[model samples]
Target chain A: MYSKEHKDYLKKIKLHNLLVKISQIFILVFFLVIWQFLASTERINTFIFSSPFKVFETIISLYQNDDLIHHIWVTVYETLVGFGLGCLIGITIASILWANKFLFKVFDPYLTILNSLPKVALGPIIIIWGGANATSIIIMALLISVIITIISVHQGFTNTDENKIRLMKSLGANKWQIFSKLVFPSNIGTIMSAVKVNISMSLIGVIMGEFLTSKAGIGHLIMYGSQVFNLNLIITGVFILCIVASIMYYGVVLLEKKINSKWD
Target chain B: MSVLKIKDLRKTYHTKKDEILAVDNFSFELNEGEFVAIVGPSGCGKSTILQMICGLDKKSSGEIEVPLNIKIGFMPQGDSLFEWRNVLKNCLLGLELTNNVTKENKEYVLNLLKTYGLKDFIHAHPNNLSGGMRQRVSLIRTLATKPDILLLDEPFSALDYQSRLAVSDDVYKIIKKEKKSAIMVTHDISEAISMANKVIVLSNRPCTIKNIYNIELENKSTPINNRKDKKFAYYYDLIWKDIDYHV
Candidate 1:
């Protein structure tokens, strides 16, 4: 049961949400249509610019050759492996650093230097060390994502309420009890946000790794396409990458929602 | 009978530059079922004394004596409730930390919640509670540990004025009804006068006790009611002057 005004208000909110979704789809379709029209009519150079239809044809051709799924899977597998291991290593290192202030202080400058350095510059070393395979790609991804995760998660742990720590200490909580019951649980939101950032970083690192070395991922397809002057293949590779990245990012968002729901 | 005693307590905080003496020669006694308030100007070493007593902060030099069997509970300035936990779980946090979550302990906490009018919200999170309700829940959380002496550090300072008065009244009643000893630190002269059985006025930075007043209101009931007692104004004036108000 509801009042007339309340029903009207609910209707208005639903209408607004629908309009927003429609506008988003409209913008994407409009861009694709304009791009397709320009390329088909030769107003733009289709060979270089690569029309939407050409990209679609390229995707179909790759699917027919049974290369599309394999390429997408390779990139996704590398990203997930690197992301998962990166988060685990980051949390462990952060906990150790939090437990020993002297160790944290000793390594502070080194972490800062590593974080600020462009990780891509180390691609040659990583390829040499891990030997130019999926291993190298995953290693590169870990290098890119692990440092930032450690910094952010450790910051979150230290930023827990001082009074809460005092209360725990007054209650005769030992160090392990304080960390487990207070510090760790309170920083779940921080850790989740770090995960969100880590996924994107991992993707970037995987793509860069594939560009330098690897034969079977989307990044490798783009590299091969550019070297052979196949504009359609390059555009198709980028489109697939976009789809994969969005799916992975949304997956993390859903996980975060699930975790927060338990708290509230 | 005195349950706890402090003698010649001192604290010195060291920074990169120099050390600052926070509390010097601070000594006090808390009896079995007495409510004492320590009031002073802001930034005084009043809270430092409570911290030392509860073993949250180490004293540079001091003697704090209590029977080994006596347990102490602490309530910080804000409610300090873990928002991720529901009210009942929050109340159980101290017990959980101490690894004493027995069936009788759970039932005792439940009884406290029911007695304090929080039975309906036993499963609700802290954010869902009002300011007054949050303070009550915080007190019950302290009470849940079954401590003989409660150390309260500016417990109501986080609330707005309206809720501060009401929650202080509520907390005073709960403390009295539970028959537990308490030592509260605050900067409010009137709050000390109305609620405390004994008020210790502290001096500035290197805190020392200026004077201790044993309140004798005509009808010293709950805090709000005590404020209306004939002698409340007289004690308030005396303690107000005793504090070394820097500003």
Candidate 2:
């Protein structure tokens, strides 16, 4: 039996929150519908702009044709392979950089330059070196993700509690034990955050690589769509890409929550 | 031989602007099983002395001599417990980090936690615990490593007044029962007088030991009870005067 005042306050807060969420969704839908209407009325050229219904129809037809699933599998395989390779190389290089202060100092400037350079520019070079195949796409993805991971993991290692390290040393713990227990656990959050950020970048790198060279994958599908002015096909490809990226991002978030829940 | 000995210890920070001295010409020694409290003004570098003793910071000049194979446990002013770790995991962190989580060590640690009334909250995360409970967990974590000497840098200063008193009594009973030597840094004169067998007062910045007060009070009294002792006010007045003079 809650008091009327208390119940009213709760009701008001819930209503306000619901209204805010509804307004956001409404605004997004309104813009999409306006775009769809404009494109369907021929106010915008169908070559450059497709109605939302046409995009949905194309996705349905693509699924029915059965080629979409194979392309999706190809892209997914390339992304997963690239992500694994990127994480391994990044973690190894980060550990090495953390172990050697002199190495970090020597390479710091060069790393900044490399990180600043647009990774897409290297698409041609990566293709030239690794061939115009999945290898090139994976290599391109690694180039985009590795630097970020290395920086995050290295910072995590360097920023571990000095007092904790000293305490471990006093307990007869060697350098390796300290690193394994203290430094590694402390950096889990940072590493997870880096992973989430890199998932999107890895996908982008793979797609760009495929766009430039691959005969298979969603990137090639989108390229074919653009060549024939099939805006619906392009939109369908873009929608699928967004879904994949969201799933990957949310996957990392879920993992981070699971790991962090224990500590929290 | 003393369990710990420091001679002419100095620590200075070299910066682009000017040379800053953190701990200058500080020296002291601690006997085994002794509880020593160091009291100083906020900026008097008391923490720097503890940091140097714990080997967290390098000494600019001096000799710190100890037994060849001695273990040191340090509790910093900050909680320093990983927010991600549960109370039990955090308490076991020192042992885990040292790879010394033997069954005996774990039993000893758990027994201490039980005795300290934290058994029920073992699985709870650090954030879920109260500030006082978190501090207790941190203290247990340090003690679980089975250090020869424990360094506490204002361990209870972060707690509320009531919790501070309760935790201080629990901690005092613990250190005594464990038969461990400890050096605690505190700005609270009453806390230092109540918890310590010997209170070392330090002068202003680039600190040096000014006076050492050996407290003789009713044994086994909590810090709050100790405050009511006749000698408590006297010692407090003396420390307050000394600190005021330096300021």
Model 2's alpha-carbon lDDT is 0.83
Worst 10 residues of 1 chain B by lDDT: B238-247
TM-scores for every candidate against the unseen true structure: 0.98, 0.87
Interface RMSD of each: 0.8, 3.2
Interface RMSD after interface superposition, model 2: 3.2
Report the C-alpha lDDT of model 1 over A78-133, residue by residue, as the tens digit.
99999999999999999889888899999999999999999999999999988989
DockQ for model 1? 0.87
lDDT of 2 by residue, B113-214 (tens): 898889999888777788777878888888888888999988877788888888888788878888899999999888999888899998887688788888
Model 2: per-residue lDDT, tens digit, A1-264?
A: 999999999999999999999999999899888988898778988667777878888888888885888899898888888787888888889888887899999999888888889999998888889888888898998899998888878988899887566556544567777777677887887788788888887898889988998878888888888888777888889988888788877887898889876655
lDDT of model 1 at position A1: 100
Q: Report per-candidate DockQ.
A: 0.87, 0.40
User: What is the TM-score (0 to 1) of chain A in model 1?
Assistant: 0.98
Docking tier of model 1: it is high
Candidate 1, overall lDDT?
0.92
